[model samples]
Target: MNRALPWIIALLISLTANGVMTGIVLHRVAGSPHVSDVVRHEHRHPPRDPSDAARTGGFNVRAFLRSLPEEQQQIARQRFASERVGFRELMLAAQNAQQDAEAALRADPYDPQAAAEALGELRARRFEIEAAMEAIVLELVADLPPEERMNALAAGRRRPGGFGRRGDRRPSPRDRF
Candidate 1:
């Protein structure tokens, strides 16, 4: 019995260390938010401004349109209607590609190639959408007076993480213009 005493103690110590590490890892995994929860939350509480102009990254065209006189707004709408339809179609395609990429990433077998291709397509779609938005913004701003054009351009140039680390708190001083 004396010969086995040290071996048994070593085994017990190893098991205890492993159990502690496993528990820590499991606790962290359980505490983190699930992907679906985030998506659901976003869907449940959509952004206040539903316009595509607000959603796109640059040149707050919608705000500029809002600032215009009623007659000008109608002219702007007419100028934008055809382009808007194309932009909407592109956005829909990008959204679908995003879904496909997510599915590929989460598949049981997890085919990396499939995920890569889906992500590539998603990226291309995003580029196309961004280019379209830029073109639209440029076209809209071309006819604007200098002061209004500057205001429209300035509205889109915001700090990336306006909310900082904590969403509930206000943005940091650096984020404010």
Candidate 2:
């Protein structure tokens, strides 16, 4: 009986360990209630690319425009030719304007009036660049076929989430309330 007792105890311990592992696997696979919280936390403060802010601030508008469809590119070329306002030229002008503002600010950082004027000029140039890019995008998007436009919209809508699908989930803590 004493020998059998040791075997029985060992079997019970092994069974308990297996049960715990199985429960964890099942919890993860079954979409535990806390999965959404985990997902939200993981995405709450997503890492920002350093260039993203600058790109958004109109620095990359010309490159973005250049990457559009061939027809759109041609249209932009024609428009630029007519108006003598090429995207690259506009980008360079914006860059020069921003550099000038920065230089002015650096030269007289203590002067509030000069700083304000420089800042205002920088803002205006950024706005102008953004507006030009937006106009170009609108014109190009308008020229796309209806089906392609719908598909592009759909693609943009589905681009945000990193999860495999709506039904995907993650494991939760055992004491989840």
Find the candidate with the highest TM-score and give its number: 1
Error of 1 at 176 (Å): 27
Clash pairs (backbone) in predicted model 1: none
Q: lDDT tens digits, residues 86-161, model 1?
A: 9789999999999999999999988999999999999999999888877766776677788876765554543233
Cand. 1 TM to true fold: 0.50
Question: What TM-score goes with each of the models?
Answer: 0.50, 0.42
The per-residue C-alpha lDDT of model 1 at residue 134 equals 74
Give the alpha carbon lDDT tens digit for every residue of 15-103 in model 2. 99999999999998998876555565563664445445433332333444434566676776676556455656767877887887777
- Candidate that would win on lDDT: 1
Per-candidate clashes come to: 0, 0
Query: Per-residue error at 43 for model 2, in Å?
Result: 22
lDDT of 1: 0.70
